[model samples]
Target: MESEIDRFPVKSLMERYSITRSVLYKRLKGLGIVPTKFGRQSYVTGKELTLLDQLHDPNCNPRDVNRWRVD
Candidate 1:
């Protein structure tokens, strides 16, 4: 059987990235990332977090998540 992938809560991501809910949602939408819902809460997979990190700009402000680019 395949091992379960690590999951992170959206609230934790907000704290980790220092972004607001709207900003996080916008960033996720821009990046074509869809959060997995569990009951009333939302979560992101480790793979998705990696993708976010890969696209993240260290120099840019955390709130400026739009600065992240795929290309």
Candidate 2:
């Protein structure tokens, strides 16, 4: 199980992936990954980030990510 410390803010994700906010959000939508939002901040876990990384990979088909589970 992942601890709370492993969670990251959406802004950090944007920077780590070197993607624009719009692009990241759009991909998140397409991937069906809804981040936990608290006020102005959005949180994503390391597991979720791994999935997102796969989704961001140019060679990985988005459709192939259906096998990924949050757990």
Candidate 3:
């Protein structure tokens, strides 16, 4: 049993952070992470983000983060 964090849309992030689309794009670029696009929009995988965060710390690279890509 584990808690699941959901994926967030680009527009949702823009509104939540009170930032423009360009700013969001810039931040993503600065972070060196690219999202996987599904359908006609872009999306950030919450699991991937968490995994990256853990990996970024250099001392906590976890073996797995819960996520399944349906295709």
Candidate 4:
């Protein structure tokens, strides 16, 4: 299968999520998704972004979040 995702760089993620770098890292850590490193920049997959959305959405149940978590 193709591995690449519609990834976003750290700067764009920060702007899109309105989160600081520290918070972004923490959230990524919580989701168990590793960011792809390119030189000094870090990028996250669209799948990861969806997980973050579920995590932050008040309408989403906590159990639903766990279903998508990476090993």
Question: What lDDT is reached at residue 38 by model 3?
Answer: 83
RMSD per model, one decimal: 4.7, 3.6, 8.1, 3.9
For each candidate, what TM-score against the reference?
0.67, 0.67, 0.57, 0.68
Off by over 4 Å in 1: 1-5, 59-71
In the range 1-71, model 1's lDDT, one tens digit per residue, is 88765888877877887878888887788767788999988888887787676545676465555555343
Ranking by lDDT: 2, 4, 1, 3
User: lDDT of each model, Cα atoms only?
Assistant: 0.74, 0.78, 0.58, 0.76
Model 4 per-residue lDDT tens digits across residues 1-71 = 88655887866877777879898777777678898999998887888877887776778775554566778
| Error in Å for residue 49 of model 2 | 0.7
Residue 23, candidate 3: C-alpha displacement in angstroms: 0.9
lDDT of 3 by residue, 2-70 (tens): 967667666676676566888766656655557777898777778645544454354642333223211
Q: Which residue pairs come into collision in candidate 4?
A: none
Instruction: Count steric clashes of candidate 1.
Output: 0
Q: Which of the predicted structures, 1 or 3, would earn the higher lDDT when compared with the native?
A: 1
On TM-score, the candidate that comes out on top is: 4
After superposition, which runs of candidate 2 have C-alpha atoms over 4 Å from their true positions?
1-5, 62-71
Candidate 4 yields a Cα-based lDDT of 0.76
